[model samples]
Target chain A: MTQPLPMPVTLLGYGAATLTTLSFFPQAIKTVRSGDTRGISLRMYLLFTLGITAWGIYGLLTGDGPLIVANALTLVPALVVLERKVQSLRRGDDRLW
Target chain B: MTQPLPMPVTLLGYGAATLTTLSFFPQAIKTVRSGDTRGISLRMYLLFTLGITAWGIYGLLTGDGPLIVANALTLVPALVVLERKVQSLRRGDDRLW
Candidate 1:
């Protein structure tokens, strides 16, 4: 039989997932604070947002709680950044980057 | 006892992971082909690279083969794009974006 994962390993996974997921926080904060996304790449964010959505769905289907939690939290800030980026581009404030 | 994940669920997870991970390929291919990263944000890539590294470590520690495989493949192209970005910035070819 396959062995259960050790508690330490599980903890490490949780920690790593949490850290990597939360790493987007600073970027989100910056976007919110500056209201400028001139430096952000619209295509990258668009693709990433879609990718995250797919992963979230996959997680739900697979019953992978870690993936679901990570992607759900990640989507919030990513969407926020994406919305601001679109707004910035529309405003013709591209020079702020 | 907890049941083993269904084969379909596992397949979905693998497929989703592969697609999302491979989604970075076009950007990497573009950067490599054009040797232009002017439109790319250095800070974003830097943070992303670090985040991927952390995830890789987590995957290794947790024995999550999916994470390891995805991130390993991902890091290769990410690093290449990052190198090109730095080079383009240094060469003052910032207008290519």
Candidate 2:
């Protein structure tokens, strides 16, 4: 933890993290802008956020900066979707696809 | 690269991998069985799979077994959803929400 990662490795990790993290954006943006929850599954996202949290914890334990950063970014959009799903499901307006 | 990760770290890594990897199951399962991709987004999943591939490459470069394994598991279900989205989009049966 004392030393910085090699440049290439750092770049790779950050690039990977950014791509993966932002991968959730389109859906999250759509959800926020439109308020549609037809095909998204509530259980899936519940597991997803929890999984992301675990990954962030692992990253912390392992001193992997990209892992932590990526999960943190990814988690935000995912939670947005999750929150919408929770709202829809609560209203009994859930889609069963 | 030669030495194995510490046991507790390895356990934590694997546990994180397993949880995050399986998070896509419910939606993928639903997509496969019911062919309902109404809520899924093609652009979202295309980016997702690419992001996962990037992560896997990063794992390979870093010699991180848990990273590789986790992304591998996560990719399968994501691709399934992507495939369905592609199909639906191709058919012009896409849902715009």
Candidate 3:
């Protein structure tokens, strides 16, 4: 049988999950502020967002709170960047490096 | 008491983790092939790499095999891209958008 995680491990997992999820914030903010996503790769973000969504589903099914929390938070910024990327592409903005 | 994850959920988690880790492979391969990371953000990658490391640690501590496997696979490509990013920066390659 699987044992419950120790308190320290749980804490670490939560902390790590929070940091990882928050890491996407800067990019989201940059995209929002500059209204530029020319440098961001659409394919990469699309795949990543999808992957995260799958991970979130996995988390929910497993009842892994850390995974659920992290992926849920990550989805917000990922979607934002993704939308902006698509918008920029439609606008004929070729500034994406 | 916490229950062990169902087999399907575990499978889904593993599958998601594998896909996510593999997703980074393209960027790593591209960077290696082109020897250019100019468009890649250094700070962004650095933080991401660190976050992944932390997540890996959390995974190890919690005995979350899915997290461990995913992050371990992810680290290989992440470090490669990260190293290339730093190398390009030092070489004065500004192509990173």
Candidate 4:
């Protein structure tokens, strides 16, 4: 059996999770609302989404509750932002390079 | 003493770490090279930088090598992007909303 994380450590992890996950909302909202993506990097979002997916899988593999929940929650808005970014690029609204 | 993570688990963690961390480089390079911040969200970068900082501290506290290394490396490019975003906002090159 694995030992439980200390209270402080667990709290900190959750805090970190909340901050990082919530941070995506503003971008997602802005992108969805404005449909602007001039400054968003396609490669960044592409790699980020893939990485977060990996992280989600890693969390699942390890049975990490915070990691799992955080990544899953993060994926939603991240995907939204990424989708908008991709759409903008496809429309030639934004340049890829 | 803590038990070592399974080989696959450790590898997955590093893979996740690598992807997420490297993901920032494109944005950073794009921002620095082009000086464009039209679509970048001020709030997103502000909060994201803070969140990544917290994650780095969390990694240190937990003595997680992958976490520590990943976050530390990620911070550099994250900071660059954030700084450019902030500068753009300050210069009225970008809007807060």
Two-chain DockQ for each candidate model:
0.25, 0.59, 0.41, 0.75
Per-residue lDDT tens digits of candidate 4, residues B61-95? 87877777887888898889888988888888888
Residues A13-67 of candidate 1: C-alpha lDDT, one tens digit per residue: 6766676577566667767776746546566567778878888988887777878
Off by over 4 Å in 2: A1-10, A95-97, B1-10, B95-97
Chain A of model 4 scored by TM-score = 0.88
lDDT of 3 at B44: 63
Candidate 3 lDDT tens digits, A5-76: 788877776676666688678768767876756556676677788889999998877677877878888899
Residue B85 accuracy (lDDT) in model 1: 75
> Ten-residue segment with the worst summed lDDT in candidate 4 chain A?
A1-10
Q: What is the TM-score of each candidate against the true structure?
A: 0.68, 0.83, 0.77, 0.91
Query: Which candidate model has the greater DockQ, 1 or 4?
Result: 4
**Candidate 3 overall Cα lDDT vs. reference?**
0.75
What's each prediction's clash count? 0, 1, 9, 0
For DockQ, candidate 1 versus 3, the one ahead is: 3
| Model 1 chain B poorest ten-residue lDDT run | B36-45
Residues B10-92, candidate 1, lDDT per residue (tens digit)?
67667667765775676677667656454465655676677788779878876778789898888887787778878888788
Return the number of clashes found in candidate 3: 9
DockQ of 4: 0.75
What is the C-alpha lDDT profile of model 3 across B16-53, one tens digit per residue?
77667787786677668767454455666777788889
